[model samples]
Target chain A: MNPALVALFMIGFTIAAYIGSLHLYRKYRRIYTTPVIVATAVIIVFLLLFHVSYETYMIGGKWIDRLLGPAVVALAYPLYQHREILKKMLVPIMTGTTIGAVVGISSGLLLSKWAGFSTEIIHSIVPKSVTTPVAMSISESTGGVMPLTAVFVMIAGIGGMLIHPLVMRYSGLTHRIGRGVGMGSASHAIGTAASMERDTLEGSISTVAMILSAVIVSIIAPGLTLLLL
Target chain B: MFKDKAIIIPIQIAMLYLIYLAGKGIQNLFDLFIPGSVIGLLILFTLLSLKLVPEWILQQGVSFMVRHLPFFFIPATVGIISYAYVFKGKGMLLIVIGLFSTALVMALAGRVTQWMVKRREEA
Candidate 1:
């Protein structure tokens, strides 16, 4: 198979899976759940069954990954637009992110240690809640494997997607700003996307929180690693 | 309007490269400290906050990414294949811990932030 052609198939397979699952989700909303999740699972299974290499898959998929930085940079506009609201909530946002970051890293480290995880695994697991790119970087710096960090980040994202709504309902958090900040900070990008389904204000704030959380974790992870390790 | 679009693309790309360079510079400084991308994000945020880099550039790049961002995960998703063996040994435990803890922390963070904001408003 021509490499270029194979790449095309890869793209097609991903889109097709997404579309198919979306169709199913719309048709059977209650039973089917999120189309993206279903589609991602299907794609993973297909790839594994065929023994496809991640390198090959990425060659075709990197066109999308390259956009991540730019997308992150673009978030500035929404933040700019919401500058007034951001200014009002700046103290709460910063303080909350700091406390959340500390608690998150500490709890993971403490629990994993108590559970008798290996030192390396404890290091790998500590930054799992942050965004993938940052988490992978922290993992690399601290001698954790990139693949492990990536999987950890993905699990964190999915968990956020599944549980955030329930958390919101249980806590009775109706305010748009509060809800957005919570989702964005905790879940990272996936949670940010989930926030979009609620409203624009929530989405924008969530985006800000996602970006901020990534920034905060990246800054704090290394120092914390040294102290904990 | 036509002039604005004409002016925007070059400026945006230049800004991106500059941001990339700034990120690189920070990475170099922190080579003994942390990852470059993390440094890069911080630099980018600082630039945006200071208004040193115009909002238009960051806006164009961020919007494009957010809309089509999920596709980016495909590449990283490939990591699963490469590290299947590593995952086989302890992946399940790691996944469970990652999931539940992330949910717990996020919920707590959100609730705390909400409470703080409410308290501030009342005061």
Candidate 2:
């Protein structure tokens, strides 16, 4: 097949999946409705059914990857919008986000090691808490598998977003800020989306938390990987 | 918001690429653990401090992007098809570890923030 044709398939598949996922979310309004999950499912099946090589998909898929930086930078809008709330909750948000980022990385490192995974796998697991782009960068810096790190991030993001309501309901953790900060710090962007489902305040706060955690974790992940991993 | 601001996407993309290059330059020079995009983020965020981009431009750009944020990640997510074999055996274990660590982070971070806020209220 022509390379351009392959790229078109990749692009068409992604756009269609995203549109379908958006419609599903509009109707269902659940985490399962998220475009990430739906697109992932559709793309996987599309690949298998068509027998397309991952490399061919990546030819155009990499265009999306390149946008990640700008996408991340775009997130600054919400962070900027939430500036006042950030100022108000600076102390606790910082302390809590930092603690969460550290615990998230350390636990991933320790657990992967305890589970008897290889050192390389463990490195991939270490930055599971941060956002995807940043986590991939950390993974590469520390010699972790790039693709694996992205998988781990989506897993962690989806898990945290889904599990938080249950955690709040059962654990008696009811504070709005508590929930938002926890989800954002632990889960990053997807978690922020989940937080947004509740109200604007939680959403904005979560966005800020995810932003702060991205910067903080990126700074510290290398050191943490060294001392602990 | 979409009418006039839609034009800003090109400008935003240009800014994003420039910021990325700045980050990439710093990255190559120093061998930092962070990615160029992140340093791009830092530069962008600090640039945010300067208030150069109009508020509507920033807001509209972000909102449009955020709505379709997951679209941008489909490639990376689907790229996992390449590494399916890596998780062939230990897939369950890796995912379990991932979930457990996430749960712990949520639990600890939430509890700590709640406790600190309560203490402040008491004070």
Candidate 3:
């Protein structure tokens, strides 16, 4: 297949998949229905069935990936939009994110070790609670595979999406701030999506937690990795 | 949404691209470890706060992009197939521990923050 055709197909396939998955997610309301998760699954199946190389798919796939940076920058609009509520609870929100980062790293380190994974895998697991872009860099610097870190981040995220309500109900961690913080800090974007489903304020708060936790964890991940490992 | 406002999106993307470029430049110059997009976010926030970049200009575009931010991550997630071998051995074990720890982080950190908020109210 020609490179240009491959690129066009890749782009068309993803856009089509994204819209289709968006509908499926809204209708089916399942984790597998998540636009990103579903789109990836569909594309992977397409690649395998068609015998296309990942490299060829990446021709235009990379273009889609390139949008992440701008997408991230776009996040500031919401944070700014909710500036008033954030200002009132600024200190508590920061406190929640900071404490969440500490717990996330220490627990990730200890649990991975206790489970008998290698040091490298353990390192990757440490940043599992942080957002993907930040987690990828931390994982690479700390001797973990970047791709593996992405996987772990997704698992943690999807895990939060599934279990957060359970944790909130049974654990008595039901404060709205706590819910937002927990979801944002632990699950990042996936959890934020769940929070958005609940309320705009909840979603905004989760956004704050997600951004703050990423910054905090990235700053402390290396130093703590040195201390703990 | 961009039907008649086609120019808004292109302009918004261009401005965001410029902000992102400035962010990348700063990251390279300062040798920072943080993601350039984050710095770009801060820059956009500052510009908005200062009234330098009119909020209305970027409002619809940015919000639309942010709403579908998850879509931007699909390619990277699919790239996970590249690391399929890592899951062959104790990889499942590692994932279990990772997931368990993520749960703990949420429960514990959230509780701690709630405690602090209660303390502040009490005082």
Candidate 4:
């Protein structure tokens, strides 16, 4: 009956479920089994079955959410590791990221508008291309639902991975740097991880693009959303 | 070796948390539009680049966090439980928007970068 005990249970359950999901993903190597989706699904199912409310779940969930900030800050270490390549290819990376960032925001807004979604949903979709923590914060500041933003971001990442081959083959994206830029700028962390699996150079370059895209999207999403939506 | 890790990893994580807090404080004081975490990321990147903070100090803890980064997002993603009504009747539309926009951005950004990189090589 103690609240703290329930909170601890929820936290432990989440970690246990995640470790299991991670194992499944490593074994199966399927998109559907991606640990984030699998772990979230299992936890949601458990809560619904037990009649636990989202608010109660958050007593523990919020603690995990709190670490998201430091995890984001840790992204800097990878960027620092690849600083030399970053410096050498700064111009092209910036150009590609700026273009990708603008298109990503505008196109999402235009499409969401055409679909007749509310402004709040539009705001969520606007930052869907950036990294999760950054996107969630942007969504919060812009009057969007943070959870929906995360879902939209997940969808974007998976979509990018699925269609990347077709896009790369037809678009003549041969260079590792270009491939990395496209994946990171458009798909964020999920894409970067997938790119890492495919090629180390691309994976590293995607790291740069992912971080830069986050910075650029955070700066631009507010003003751009105001203009479009 | 095990004892050293036991001491260092926590300290490194603590240092990261301190930077994150400082970033939040700066954001509040300056009225910046950027999120505190991102501000923290930039600060850490600057510190790493300037060699003010040695890489070895934060390397293990940072790598551990980065490796399991997706784990942190699970809780937030599960918050979708409360917003199911908002997404009803809009699932197909959102999927279409995500797929279409992602593909477009990838192609265009890739093409532009490829062109620029090729031009540089030719020059």
Candidate 5:
């Protein structure tokens, strides 16, 4: 089989799968149907079923992966756009997110240690609470498995959304600021989406928290992971 | 979305790539621990805030990338297939950790922020 042909096929197939999954996600709106989750599943199944090696997939996959860095850099746009709200709630948001970042890193590290998981797993989960790109980068920098880190991040986002109501009820997180900060700080973009669906202000605050937490976690997770782990 | 001005999109993306390269150069030069993308984000952010880089330069390109951010992650996520051994028996444990830690962080962060807001109002 020609390598160029394989690369082209893999690239086109991935795009098509993502588009189809995106539609399914919009229509059904379930965690399992998330475009990335669904698309990855579809691709992985296709690879396994047809006996396609990950290395072959990477021939084309690397091109898509290359864009990830620039895309992450582009995140500054949203962060910049939301500067007004960020300015208004700087103190509380910062206070909440800093604490959240510490708890997020420490809890993952300690729990994995208690469970007897290996160092690799511990490093992966440490940055699980931040957004995917940042989390993946952190995972890479820390010698964690990038794929496992992404999966843990997805789990964290979904789990945070699922438990939002219960946590709010028992934790007295009634205020919109608290709700937003909590969701975004803990869950990243997916939690921000869930928060948005509940309240506009909460959603906006969640966006701010989401971006701010990324910066906070990025700066601190490496040092904190070493310190606590 | 750009209508006939579509050429601008790639150019803007190229501009972003240049910044990413600059960030990587800095990371290598200083032996910094942070990823170049994040450093690039900070550099671009500072440029935007300081009015050195016009927002319009990044408008469409950045939006396109951000909107389809999930798409870019698909390949990496798909790479999970290779890690079967790592996750084979730890499914339950991972789920428990994911759920528990997430809940705790959400509760505590929310509580602290709400408490601060309340105290500020009282003051």
Candidate 6:
């Protein structure tokens, strides 16, 4: 297949998946558990069984991934539109993100060492709390594979999404501000999406926290990795 | 929905190309410094915050991308296939440690943040 043709097909498939998932989400109103997960699993399984190389897939997929940065920036408009509420909660949001980023990196390093993981793996895992791009960069700078960091970050996001509600219930943490910051800090973009589905205020707060955590982690991870390792 | 739909598609394509150009420009500038995508996002955020680009233009493109963002990761995920042999040894131990420790830290971070917020609220 021509690379251009493959790219077109992949874009078509991606758009179709998005539309289908949106439909299912609207019907089910359970954004986290349904369409996206099912679509991702099915497509991934198909790709794997067919022996599609990631590079080949990415010949098309990179076009989509290229937009991730701008998309993140686009999040600001919705955030800006809701600036009044955001202004009110800025203190809690900033404080929560700072605390979350610190604890996340510290505990990850500590626990991985305790579990007998090597320094490289520990370095990779510690930044999983940040968004993927930042985590991958941090991992690379600290002598970990960018690809491996990507995987760990995705897994962290999925894990945070799956378990957060249950954790919230168990811990009796119900305030939207607390929940939003915790979700954003722990899960990055995925958790931000989950919070958005819950409410606009929650989503905006989570977006702010998520971005702050990523920036903070990027700055702090490299220095900390040197000291700890 | 249909009226907006028609406009959204073209606008999204245009915005995506513009973002691509912006990203490339950023990458070029930062290639001498750091990686470009990080700088590109920062630049984009700055632009958006400054209202240099209209929100509506970027919003559709962003919405389109975010909705299907996971699919973009499929290629990266499949890279694990080539590493299966490499992963057979100590790699397994590393992955186990990595996944669980990352999760544990994430949970701890969430809990600690919540605690700090609670303490602040009480004060």
Top lDDT: which candidate number? 4
Residue A209 C-alpha lDDT in model 1: 76
Q: Which has the higher TM-score value, candidate number 1 or candidate number 3?
A: 3
Model 5, docking class: medium
lDDT of 5 by residue, B1-123 (tens): 456447887888888889998888998899775567768878998999999988877798887777776677778767767765555676578778988899999999999999987887688
Count of backbone collisions within predicted model 1: 3
Model 2 regions lying over 4 Å from their true place: A140-143, A196-200, A214-229, B1-13, B118-123
Ranking by lDDT: 4, 5, 3, 2, 1, 6
lDDT of each: 0.69, 0.77, 0.81, 0.85, 0.83, 0.67
In terms of DockQ, the best-performing candidate is: 3
| Per-residue accuracy of model 3 over B1-123 as CA lDDT, tens digit each | 455567788688777878888888898899887778878988998888788887888887786787777777777767767676777777767667767787887888788767776777688
Per-residue lDDT tens digits for candidate 2, residues B1-123, read 466565777776666667678887997799775566657666766667678766665565566765566677777777767766766777678988988888888888877877776787678
- Per-residue lDDT tens digits for candidate 2, residues A41-137, read 8888988898877887898788778887776666666666667766877788778888988999899998888888999899888888888868888
RMSD of each predicted structure: 4.1, 3.0, 2.5, 2.9, 3.9, 3.8
For every prediction, compared with the true complex, DockQ reads 0.39, 0.56, 0.65, 0.64, 0.56, 0.33
Worst 10 residues of 5 chain A by lDDT: A192-201
Reported per model, the fraction of native interface contacts reproduced equals 0.46, 0.63, 0.71, 0.77, 0.76, 0.23
Candidate 3 chain A weakest lDDT stretch, 10 residues: A193-202
What local lDDT score does residue A83 receive in model 5, on the 0 to 100 scale? 71
Identify the superior model by lDDT, candidate 1 or candidate 2. Answer: 2
Per-residue lDDT tens digits for candidate 1, residues A41-88, read 787788778888777776666755554554455444555566788888
Q: Write the per-residue lDDT of candidate 4 for residues B7-121, one digit (tens) a residue.
A: 8887888889999998889989997766688789889999988999988888899988777877887777787788677556766778888889998899888789888988987
Task: Give the Å error, residue B58, model 3.
Answer: 0.7
Name the runs in model 6 displaced over 4 angstroms: A21-32, B1-4, B16-123
TM-score of chain B of each: 0.68, 0.75, 0.86, 0.83, 0.81, 0.73
Question: What is the Å distance of residue A157 in model 1 from its true position?
Answer: 1.3
Better of 3 and 4 by lDDT: 4
Clashing pairs in 3: none
